[model samples]
Target: MLTLWCPSAASMESAKHAPVSPVLPSYEQEQHLHAFHACEQRHEAMARLLVVVWDEPGRCDLRAMTHVVTAHLRRHDTYHSWFEERGGAIVRHVLTDPTVIQMEPRTLGEVRAEDWQRHVMATPHPFAWDCFRFGILQHDRGFTCFASIDHLHADATVIAFLMAEIRSAYRAVLDGEGPLQLGPPGSYLDYCASQRQRAAAMTLADPEVKRWIAFLHRNGGRMPSFALPLGVLEDRYHAEYVHLDILDDAVMDAFESACHAAGARAIGGLLACAALTERGLAGRSRYSVVTPTTTRRSPKAFRTTGWCVGVVPIDFDVQQRAFPELALTAQRNFDERLSLAEVPIELVLELAAGLPTVGSVATGGVMLSFMDVNVPPLSAHIAREWHQANGRVYINQGIAAQVAIWLFRTPRGLSLTAAYPANETARASMHRYVKAFAGACRQAAEALMPTYSDAGREQ
Candidate 1:
């Protein structure tokens, strides 16, 4: 059974009286809401995961953590209204008493292998309507936390930002400072209204529509599906974050050199690797990669804080060309899609629905996957600080599919995280997949560099 940690009467009353404020509509927020509404129309739900990390025994402080979270909530105008609008969707409750647990901690690896499993299995979801719940678990050494956020509210990027903010607030409390104040901007509801107005004004040009129609007709008008390999299903879902260091010098020289030589951009190089991986694993020649775009294209929609984000579908052909050529092709398609990004993903999904569904052989009974690349304004310094302070961070953990590859550019290089169900394949296989992906990226870069002749002249 699920649990409802109802606020006290006074707390409830205070929440009711909380001032409503405006917020800016971020491109991400609007697109997310559009997708949510689209999925809701089909009676489907969005599921996400949040992982939190805590300090070793001497460092763990549940009371301090809670205080920080509450204070963070109080100071941020966006959160105040966000919670208020949802009738305070966020909850605070203890699973196990902190007084009984020691603050001194242990290593994260050991804690993850033991304490995390025990707590999650024992605790129920916190809210009845909550797509997921969060838990704070104490271990003999350190602590770890988990949350399953519903997809309707926001995507992973927003959740990550919120967790970082919570950690910062907690640290501030520890330092005897007040919580961080987030000024008012706009509301999500307003963003939705704005989206409708903008969408109405725009119509696909006959030529553009014809292009899409022609592409669909040529390709049999069906989207390909990605099936998770059956071998991986036995392992529980696990998340790991890995970084691909592209130093500033490398970024300016090697990265750009590789991209330009391949006729691809930074993002294109990454997508090309994804496309290659899909072909290698599934033995499919054609596939689609879903990339997200912020919906803050309209100045009016800026500052509105609802779920304004959309996913653009870029189809790639793996069969006809070399990986480098495919990379450039993917890049061209990606750029074209970006130009038309203002169209909400919901509308695109709706458009796709109009076409006939042509089923393909399922390598593992899954189809339709996405590779999300988020380069938001949030920095790694903040992410690391939050993870060190809190046991976990909230990220958009989309539903389990063949795989979801998340690449975030950091000061060190590129941070690559892959979330897949353990039951789907062996650890060795997954590891190989990651390696292949990395190798492909390197090869694509190398292919993009200018070749020199024996005379030392550029070819």
Candidate 2:
């Protein structure tokens, strides 16, 4: 069992007026609003993964960690608005249990495979007005903390980045450095304001926008939903971490070669891997992956922090072409989507008022599967350290029960994980799917290597 301590009224009051600007809503927010409205109409729970990574100091100090986290909240507007926008509630909690903390292992592989499954199932949703709960686990080498956040509030990228920053702050405090001054906190409201200005200023749609609109028109304005195997409903969600080594020299060589040979960016390579994985799993061609693209294509958005992201579909037909060819296709699609990502999906839906809604598509028998490939700015050492971290590093959270795949890249290689509901497929089937996906990745990499080398020589 874990115990939680509520913050003092005085503390809450003082934290309320922290200096922060309001961010305008981006096109993404408009889409989310539409989705939320739809979900409200259907009364179905919106699922998301809430993850927490704690440092391995081997001690349990719920209050201390909370205090450290709270202090930073004072300086960051994003932190403040996050809690405020959610009805003046922060869905977060702190757990103080030495036994729980002691159970986590020090190394990534040593972490119990069942830990993730148990954590997700047993974890309770924070009350509509309460902050998220944080569970502390003790391992032989250090302590681990767990949190299951609601996806409706924030996606994994933001959550992961926030967690990493918090950990960095906590570690700095532990080292006797006063909390690092993270510059003036950017407000989400400000971002929203900027978005409004951009939208207002735009008169003509770009070519990419035209292409997307045409695609939407061809598809009849229905968004596809991924199908989950029925087996997922029976078994609990469990997580496993797999590590692959890509030495510094190898990573640099691979990065340069892939970029030059394919005329694609590093992220393109990651997407190509995802396409290969999907090809291996479905064992067919003509599949589409919906991925999130940051709307911060403009220089102004570079420094601004807000939820300015929208989903775009990348369609691939593996049977019709080779992996390299597919990689090029994926790259082209990604580039085009990024250019027009500023347009909100909600706006598109609104513009096509007579088109069928997502619900209607579900009723009409269209299955949608997606791959979210997150390639964070990777430095060689940081990638190595993540691989070295203890506990299972999972790429997928089986929240939708659909075949959702997540890819995280490091200097060594890519770490790919897929999550499916246990009730949806047999264990053998799931394993086979994973194996096939891995093989596709290897084939894609091998086929691209020579092309990359030849391009490098030409250069």
Candidate 3:
């Protein structure tokens, strides 16, 4: 089984000597997964939320939707599992409660979209017993569902699956005149168990994972220079973030085509953009970006909410290449790293002993994530609008990092959210950086031919 990276030496020894973990072998979990682990280790709630409004009154069985969703939740231990910080390593305790899944009813027109954002900020989602919540807001127009989820339990992909499952369950409810029978869920624990077995096969002594650890070890880890000076002073519990709507439909389509043309994934392309931006402003040519990817290898795993995310750090040395060339290189690197993305962060932590406890040191420098909400298009839902706020930290965890760039692709195109420390100077710098990022991407998309693009490339 893959060893859990314990924050304490005592826990490490316990994991080594103990015959069987409190939970299953996989129950030890991927608590060692880069920044993904922090959701469990830290005291903060680390709550993430989602707001969905289904305007269409077409055969929408609210009760059935809730029923099937709750049924689905019961299937995955990861969602129901409450992780407690025991001794040193985290222990997963899975408990099922019917009260936890009820989607409460709320007065619809009363709650604005921004209100949901403020609500999550003002009242942090506690990581105590129940880690997930659902509420239905009733309005004059349509019905909206608000979900407050603990990041400790689910990452982006898991969250996506949760939303998709709800929609699918609603469909199933509609399909079966009354009874919504969701055939048995392929056990998520089994997946984790398999991962543990695979991890055992690929021991820490495996040269590939070890090489990465040693390579990052030399640079004193992936800690980047924290955000520029500006914004809220009290880092913790106060969110300092900016959201940008970068592309409309036409441009977004071209951007995707450009990604295909340039042979780059969305995350890699963004990394290339950020890298080129940094090269000009900071005179730094290369950037190491920690990209979080979901390891949804099976269709069954994709159907449930669970933590199978990995931090795939891509080193972007695109100083000499044109945007298209950078894209091709980034795509190649993304694929290679993803193929071996299972390398445990615990191993890296064990090797880099004294490194500063900062935000995701294993793949630090900057975290760039691209999420295309993997659900049926929003048009399918009956709702006037939809709102989402992902990874908005109320209190800064005091990780010395340059910035975290999150890219979300909606039907409207790209929504870029940048989170950094609260500093006036840093805010100004972030503005410039974002402007540069947008400009770089636009130019890159137009200049698909590296041969011609290199001439106009930003030096």
Candidate 4:
């Protein structure tokens, strides 16, 4: 099992003193600008990815760990980059000078990782520079590495990449080999420039832009909200987090087989299950959601530590449909929607001025993210080297009206993590929803049992 850790006073102080030397030529991307403005407008804890790296007992040398972190900060462009508002627009700022964040590992003491996570998340990091926080916690049996980076700078994929690099670096340093000579990660700023160029060449008449406009139009020209009622009226309140082990390996294996038999992938099967649960709980026949997708199309960005992600709206009717049928439709819908996944909703809003909105509809809507961690960089080192049982992503722990669910498929099993508004009614509602979701998933797996059984008999 992975453990948690908190930062010492010295480490926090180091973050404060980290210097940033700004270089010229600023660039902007829709997603980054939207995240920056949202951070500017909200005082609450924003979404961040919290990662914990496990190590042998008492073997977590502070000196070696500091070297590892300093080396990572130097290699990733995002770590050396920040944002600033200039003449009413948020622009990127890069630090050319040496950027080093000291790592001082203190004992775990009495502080729980959850509480410390909230405290660190609540404590704002500087957007001008050093927007990420890192720490180490030493325990009797072992030590763990802890770090948090907001949505503006990092996502789950980026976190996975960085953690693998850190593990490799830390191991090397421990063996007295020092930092590895891995080349710099692909520049996120260059990716942003490409995004701007692609967006610039398009107009309102472009099919992708029109498709987004239609999606918004279908949802009252705003982002889709949670169909279930949230009892709170306040804008900000305490948030509740729920982790559900939805399926064991055996059941998940059967479910994946069922999905294959039905001509759908496991992701599609899972989406069908979620849609069924939504319909059962809220009596809604239509399931609509904004799912996040990565934009790292270039192989060079396979290790880039940037927020190169986009949100795609997926919706389908789930009325009187069987599990396999719904799963197939969901898969097709999800696959077909990727053509416009790279198109930013902010750009869509900009080009289509006639679209109605009370305020920014770019965020604060129901979102679902799914990832099979067995892919590429994550699979290469996650379980073997990192063993990160506690390395999870945290989003919108502050006030929120909608629920955001992250589904991660690991070697162990498929698990669901959700964040929702904290209220008695919301809490009860989410638990029921989770239960329904799990039930639907199991039933889907069971439904395919007969087909497999018949095949076995025929053989």
**TM-score for each predicted model, relative to the true structure:** 0.59, 0.65, 0.73, 0.84
Best by lDDT: 4
Better of 2 and 4 by TM-score: 4
lDDT of 4 by residue, 326-407 (tens): 8999899889898777887777777877545423446556788888777665674564444444454445454444578888
Q: State the weakest 10-residue window (summed lDDT) of model 1.
A: 94-103
Higher-lDDT candidate among 3 and 4?
4
**If ranked by TM-score, best first, what sequence of candidates would result?**
4, 3, 2, 1
lDDT of 2 by residue, 73-97 (tens): 3443333332223442122221211
Worst 10 residues of 4 by lDDT: 20-29
lDDT of all predictions, in order shown?
A: 0.46, 0.46, 0.54, 0.68
Candidate 3 lDDT by residue in tens digits, 1-459: 000110123322332332323444242244422233464466443324432223223433555655665565556656544444555555555443423433322223355656655554432333343445454545455444445554545555554445545655666677775554445455565667776676656655777666566446434554343323444343333236788776654565566677777777666677777778877677776665667777767666665555666667567575677777887888888887785557656545654465463224333245778887524322313111233312122222333324677887765667788776556676788888888888777766665433434443332
Candidate 4: C-alpha RMSD to true structure equals: 5.2
Question: For candidate 1, lDDT tens digit of each residue in 213-318?
Answer: 4444444443323323435442223333233432232332455467677788777767777778767776768757556656555433333323556655578677
Clashes of each: 64, 46, 20, 0
Candidate 1, after superposition: displacement of residue 33 in Å? 11
Residue 455 in model 4: lDDT = 34
